[model samples]
Target: MEEKSWSELLAEHSPELAQISRADGEFLDADSALPAWVKQLMAMQMDAVFNHPHGARWYGRRARELGASREQVVEAIKLLRIFGGRPAMATGAEGLREPSE
Candidate 1:
């Protein structure tokens, strides 16, 4: 089988995706519930942030603290938006993680 893009997965399972992204009472256990591919994509995105300039270092340091790769953090930034951030929401639904309050 071929791998699906994050967006593809999100579109296919939008409601379930929303539930997981919302971190609602039901989303808290997402780690076990979400697909492993989504987790991997999230991790990859976190690592990619180190490539950025402005807050790259700060993000890198924070990524270390969070135990997520810089790419994963980057990915989380996107995901956070999709789950509940701002207008950027539509852009990164693939690896979206329901933001934690």
Candidate 2:
């Protein structure tokens, strides 16, 4: 099996990807007062619990960029039920636990 770019996947299956991504970005970008790390980490937590592998990874990078600590990211992964998070919870926990320095 081959992997598809988001654009390719959306074109073949989820044509609404752009709109959904835009909407989600708007929601996450809403208030100026909230710290970037907070918003990214919150989104990561949702992605972790929901078992969105690509989305979780995407959130992980964003959270890292915004200064999410390893411990904080782990806490986010722990939000998932065993099955609910699936590959994402496991993968996120493993990846986020890596030493920063």
Candidate 3:
């Protein structure tokens, strides 16, 4: 079976919810003192700490694309270990693994 795009899945579930999510994303993505990459890294850390591995990976990849270094990502994961413990650190590390292109 083919994988469904995020929009497609959201549409199938709830278009209104998807629209709200997009709006919230746009609001959060607005200009700020922090750079885009920093924001992505912050999101990754929060996701990892919350046990949201998929979000952690996605934000980590986005952070890299926005000019964050691997070392930066690793550091963020390490910092989160205090709050999230070993399991969270392990899950966050999944972002380090290359995803299939």
Using all chains and alpha carbons, the TM-scores for the candidates as numbered come to 0.24, 0.50, 0.64
Decoy 1 TM-score against native: 0.24
Candidate 1 local lDDT, 20-91, one digit each (tens): 655542332244666443454444444453344433444445445545565665667677555444544455
Q: Arrange candidates, best TM-score first.
A: 3, 2, 1
In candidate 1, stretches whose alpha carbon ends up further than 4 angstroms from where it belongs are 1-60, 85-101
Model 2: lowest-lDDT 10 consecutive positions: 76-85
State the lDDT of candidate 3 residue by residue for 19-96, as single tens digits: 987886665465478877888888998987788999999999988887889999999888887766877678888899
Top candidate by lDDT:
3
Greater-TM-score candidate between 2 and 3: 3
- For model 1, what is the alpha-carbon lDDT of residue 83? 48
Between 1 and 2, whose TM-score is larger? 2
How much does each candidate deviate from the true structure in C-alpha RMSD?
18.5, 12.0, 11.6
User: What's the lDDT for residue 83 in model 3?
Assistant: 61
